[model samples]
Target chain A: MPPSGIRRRPGGRSARVRATVLAAVDALLAEVGDEGLTLDAVAERSGVHRTTLYRRWGSVPMLLVDLLDAGTEDDWRAPDTGSLEGDLVAINREVHAALTAEPSVTAAVVAASFRSPEAGEALRRFWEDRYERCAAVVHRAVERGEVPPGTDPRRLLVAATGPLYHQRILLGGPLTREEADAHARAARAAAASGLL
Target chain B: MPPSGIRRRPGGRSARVRATVLAAVDALLAEVGDEGLTLDAVAERSGVHRTTLYRRWGSVPMLLVDLLDAGTEDDWRAPDTGSLEGDLVAINREVHAALTAEPSVTAAVVAASFRSPEAGEALRRFWEDRYERCAAVVHRAVERGEVPPGTDPRRLLVAATGPLYHQRILLGGPLTREEADAHARAARAAAASGLL
Candidate 1:
């Protein structure tokens, strides 16, 4: 077994191996969806042998959970746009890009979550952390008098993101940039009304 | 072969077969989540033969789609509550109940839609049809001058539903009755501001 619980490099491999494995997960998701994604395929695609892959992640579910965890920390740091609308627009755009740019990975993770409590827990934690951070932005807007003092910033943040997820899964759409803009505007407007 | 493209029971056999199959699907989903759900399991649990199951739905995806289509017509119907908020609350409550009550099925259908264009298309039809129907309730609010003119009722409706889906998938929380009420009010307030 490799030291530090990571394999694929004896002495040291750049942290790039993690990224490579994540990309493999993404690619496999795009090709096979959720039910068909397998650890062997990930190992082959990642060019990391089965032993290394197994040592790193005991099972497909564990590997997937790691991949998803990698995704969460990639770009969750939202841009500071100053204005409520500007911040929302920028964040919405970033989220929209992430979900749409890798629709397959996003969908596969969502599906896997349904079957694996570990995946579900990972997703829930990602959201809570992300939402809490995003809520800070909305709260700043309220402090600036851009929105009503009574606005539920947490709920507003969720409202801003709700449509894109809905369209992709339940509503069946690509969640385009235009759609992101519309949802942001609507969420901001609602916040301003002290209703969110 | 049985009549009407489904495996019909022998003459005078009770309609209980279909009901049993559906109940079996629901049970499987609740216990197994999406990945663990399988056609063979459904048949075996329901005490039906594999031939009978295959003759009824053709494939797992087909069975899932049919299972979704069955007994769900009344679930999506919008209520006439004389006000947009009231109507929205009703719709939101129904959705909350449905999701919380059947997380397994909800997760399964969503995951399947990711890989199957047919499932994706069916989800689209379901959303558009239900949203259009729900929009009528919002339009009624406009007629009452409760919301501003030129408001996109459809967008407003989307705002209301967007958070529920987000919270369900990301927050790991239950869709309580209180959340539904809050979403309806937020959606209405957003609409009144011409945000929709």
Candidate 2:
């Protein structure tokens, strides 16, 4: 038996529980969508106690908010490849990959965004955090004289990823790697022209 | 009861029923989202018989599909002001208006797109039809020597509208009229630079 009475390392068990619960959230979202998800279902699926889940997450919307916050934290580091185009391509490709790889989860989160104010707040924070994190790519590009000064990084990033999102979510179309590359290229061109 | 027993004019009552059913769909979608909407609920709200709804729409997804088709048909006429920039701006503004004015319905339809293949097909058809209908703006621009020959109309339109959709749907951000104008200007700039 693993030291049943011993004090656990600070945050170790808590982190593990968070990971397990979030993973269950992901699984449930992927399998049944946000509409069918519930705290009890999450508890049963994660094998975490219902009381703990209730105390921690409180509600389905809050759980989804936490899940989005957790999900975006891992994969959104800015890439620096010595060129603006390179950095942008890297960012666009990562976005396309994430959106495509787990479309169901993306859909679930997006649906939740419309249905729940908490989820919307979480999503907004996620995008804002992501934008702030990646703003360095544009700063680097400006220093390298690859683009003019005052080129807005957030606007450029939005231009780069907007088409892909539109195609995937609104148009219900496929977002190919080639399309991602083209979007990045177009954004770069627009930036080079000082449009961004 | 003036002419109750007489043969009704072709598509008169049928059109009214469709309009009523679709309006009920919109209301339900706005009130409870797609997850909570059902044909029986729509029947109760629409005052159309459930069996009639089943016979006509067959399912909620089909009803949503029809609703989308009908909605787009009325709102998506191509605006031609004899200038590419003007037309594009008009298109962008209309899109922004529609997406913003009824975000809940938009979100519900988008959510349905992810959950149901039938809805996806309907949405795809809706977009394709809209694109086809709006291709004239770019064509007219080319004819007027405003844009380069062979500018892909669909590509230009996508670039024009993608950021708006991205902001409204994915980022859950507000799309201002100024932003819509800016998007149109940027798309025009990109097109002028042979980037589109």
Q: DockQ scores for all the models shown?
A: 0.50, 0.41
Which candidate has the top score in TM-score? Answer: 2
Native-to-model Cα distance after best TM-score fit, residue B8 in candidate 1, in Å: 14
Please, what's the RMSD in Å of model 1?
A: 5.0
Docking band of candidate 2 = acceptable
lDDT of 2 by residue, A44-106 (tens): 999999899999889898998998789577865799888989998898888788678653777
**What are the per-residue Cα lDDT tens digits for candidate 2 across B1-196?**
1366235654677888899999999999888878889988999999999999999889999999898789567865799887888998998888888677753677678768766778878888888889888899888888888878967787788878898888877787777887787778778877776666
Q: lDDT (CA) for every model shown?
A: 0.75, 0.82
- Candidates' interface RMSDs, in order? 2.4, 2.3
TM-scores of the first chain across all predictions?
Answer: 0.81, 0.87
True contacts kept of 1: 0.70
Steric clash pairs (candidate 1): none
